[model samples]
Target: MSLTRVLWFAGVIITLAMGIRHSFGLFLEPLSAGGGRETIAFAFAILNLLWGAAQPFAGAWADRAGARRVLVAGALAYAAGLWTLAVPGMPLLGSVMIGIGLAGTTYGVVFGVVGKLAPPHRRSQAMGLTAAAGSLGQFLLLPAGQWGIDHLGASPTLLVFAALTLLIVPLAWPLRVEGIERPSQPVGDAFREAMRHPGFLLLSASYFVCGFQVSFVGVHLPAFLADRGLSSSVGALSLALIGLANIVGTWLFGHMGARHDKSRLLSGIYACRALAIVLFVLLPVTPASAIAFSAAIGFLWLGTVPLTNGIIAGIFGVHYLSMLGGLVFFAHQLGSFFGIWLGGRVYDSTGSYDPVWWASVVLGVMAALLCLPIRERPLQRAEAGA
Candidate 1:
């Protein structure tokens, strides 16, 4: 019942969930050694799609049945999904299972509980701290994952990660809310209301760009660096740098979200992302430059998470925060599906990632424009508790 206790457990769980997820890029080289770049990318793409598609349902169930149930189930599935990756012919199944598992274990379910635990005034900060914990995981775990692949074989490394993921099962208990927080309106009515809101639509559209840009970079950046004659360690360090910067960025943005206009903040973050990508690509490829780029992009990374969720909570109220956030995240994942799959397709055909990099810049500008118009206030119905 203590907010501290809840945030602590929730933060650890996110660290594990997101940390491992971020390291998936590290596996691409090892997996693609047999010439299946698209295959691996598609598997990851499926993971994002399934995670997005299942999130609303997962969040809804957490809203009603409690997050412990959803999180524990998700942890089991996540572990199973990882173990399944050891099977030589079942990457698709592994990806699908992991995707569904991620839906239950990560943002939607965890934020649902945290949203209820923290008071409205401190809500954005709490979410930011929790998301920062995830960035910390990325910072710590990326190198560890790369080490595992270096020492143990990739399959063995995956098995170890599977074992580690099971830790989420016990971590789920501390996150249990005291009681269900019922929505002010029926679930169907909430969905319909969200559908009619222009701001939510615009927010979701911009989030799609977030997903497209982040996913493409997360999955393909390693290969892109390799194509430029960088070592695998450079690639791993680049992702770790992103994670490291994300810790500050997520926390800073979350703290600011409490004070500023979240929509405008989001617009700036996207614009910065486009600028970072442009600089990274146009400049020469070197380890120092990659690290600088990673740090810059990373600072802007996942800053979107807390801000986006905070905006949704502001607009919809916390009672349906998880479900509404899930809906918005589904848009993000849809962008992820395209961005990642497209990166692989383009690279496979053109032998370069230049086109997708340009596409990300274009989408970033569009998202920045889109965020300018979002009305961050709650609906009248929500304010009135109708």
Candidate 2:
């Protein structure tokens, strides 16, 4: 298949898969209203853990088998998870299954394939474009999810989402590669080697903050807005704007990664996130303020994905891209688990999200600091040097 076609297919898969995943947080309130916030939060927290846990295996499968198999299986799991989620009293089941589904369909698997397909010069741009599609999904689907809740309620809306995930089945076909690309080292050895590299460790550590902050907001922001006496539609619009801003942010960063030090770019993005969060919290929460905050954070949202992937590909090469990326993402999901779980726990104890917001701000600064030291070049290996 043509590279253009591959990118198109990969982009659509990301959009649909991420669209449903991003909007699932909308159901947190409706589901938890009965079970209490902790129950729902735990379920989401588990989902993040499972999503992270499953990623390395999913990526390895894609690397060893093919993207087609992993993606199709994910699409099926996604449909089942959504269907289960629609049924009342199945939050944990739905969360675990959907989290499992997302592992196969999301960044590691899709971008790994794209990394292999795109030429070296253009790979970052391809990943940026793909990440942008995921943001576009958030922008396009948040309102649709909000609309579904308004008209159909959460259960039926999830059933609608079950149908939506099925769309990924066809999209995965184009990503099927002829064979695994040759790696500089065996997959097993690469993971062991990368783990020892300071740059890789720093990259993973910073990504944890990314997962923590983004998942916290993605899952809880709607309810956060509701707590402030804003309409749910306002929350929906805010999410849409975040998604819209991500399109530009992701593309710009992708282009810049090609030309600049991606590590500095990452540091810049993280610093921007810290400043944005501080400004958001210090300022009063008005409808205008809320919308502006969404736009600001959304630009920084998911922009890290391509740059991180580009760095990994630069350091480790594409042969083991999926596996390495997934391992890095696992750290991200660990942070995600804490972020989602803590948001509710803190709220349940204090009746405020103030602490959580401040924690994220601090993490943003730490992430910025860590990102600066990442070596954005290929890993030095005796085998490759020979």
- Candidate 1 to truth, TM: 0.98
- For model 2, the stretches where C-alpha displacement exceeds 4 angstroms are 384-386
> What digit string (tens of lDDT, one per residue) describes model 2 on residues 1-386?
77788888888999998887888678888888755687888888999999999999999888888889999999899899889988888989998999999999999999888899888889889999999999989989889998999899999999998999999998787787665555546777878988998999999999999999999999888889899999888878888888999999999899889888999999999999999999988998889999999999999998899999999999988888899899999999999999999999999899998999999999999999999888877765785546
RMSD of each: 1.5, 1.5
C-alpha lDDT of candidate 1 relative to the true structure: 0.91
Taking all chains together, each candidate's TM-score versus the true structure is 0.98, 0.97
The 10 consecutive residues of candidate 2 with the worst lDDT sum are 177-186
Question: 42, model 2: CA deviation in Å?
Answer: 1.3
**Cα shift from native, residue 72, model 2 (Å):** 0.7
